[model samples]
Target: MLRLSKKTDYALMAMKHLALHGDRGASSAREIAEQYDIPAELMAKVLQRLVRRGLLLSHQGTRGGYQLARPATLMSVADVIQAVDGPLTVTACSTDDHACDQYTKCSVRDPLWRIKDRILTALAACTLAEIVDDTSVPTIPVTLSRRTPAPVTER
Candidate 1:
């Protein structure tokens, strides 16, 4: 199953909190972590990673903390995730890297690559603003809907 690491999850939560309360000035990592019941040390590490990645700006002072380096609308979710977890990869051997032992006979490799690209595209298209905003963000076309289809009728 596809999943985001715990650190990545913390980074996203911190970002949303920062976006929501950014206007109030920089927020200390402890403050944000406490709001969500996360470990302060771990959240601080995540924020530091974001800071190093240029996704967040760190302020050094008595009242200083961390804040978004740019507008939330301009930063994609992919940026945040990548900063926290490096690159996103769903398969063992992506098209660019066929280092897997089964690369030669892997029939599903190419198709999985396409699916990986789609996932990356979707992540890159979604902005951090959408996470904290109540308004709708544009929806992506989905091949599968979780809901069951109604019975077919005779035309």
Candidate 2:
């Protein structure tokens, strides 16, 4: 199943937290971790990775903490995910590694690659600002309007 790693999830949470408090100055990793009930050590690692990726700025000292390197609107979900988990791949064949033994006869590889592209595009379209601003809504609307069939008459 396609799923985001836990580190990516934590990174998104931390980014959203910072975005929400962008005007409040930098926030310590501990603060963000405590706010979301995540492990402080893990959050620190995630935040450090973000910093290395240039997505976040880290400060040092008594009041040191972390903040977004750029506006949340300019940072896409894909950015955070990629920073912590690398590229998004729905199938083994979708990646350049291509270690699958069936590479020579993989019939679904092309379709899977297309699907992976679509997923990545969708993630890219979603910015951290949308999440932090509570504006993240599905592009496609879903309706549950199926009618219930009447009970069959007894014979």
TM-score of each: 0.87, 0.86
Cα displacement (angstroms), candidate 2, residue 87, comes to: 0.9
Ten-residue region with minimum lDDT total, candidate 1: 133-142
What C-alpha lDDT, on a 0 to 100 scale, does residue 141 get in candidate 2?
57
Q: What digit string (tens of lDDT, one per residue) describes model 1 on residues 56-130?
A: 999999899999999999999899999999888888776688688899998887788788888989999899999
Whole-model lDDT, model 1: 0.91
Runs in model 1 deviating more than 4 A are 95-98, 144-155
Task: For residues 1-155, write the lDDT of model 2, one tens digit per residue.
Answer: 99899999999999989998979899999999999999999999999999999999999998789999999889999999999999788776655666889988888888998988988998899899888877564575557668977889999
Clash pairs (backbone) in predicted model 2: none
On lDDT, the leading prediction is 1
lDDT of 2 at 15: 96
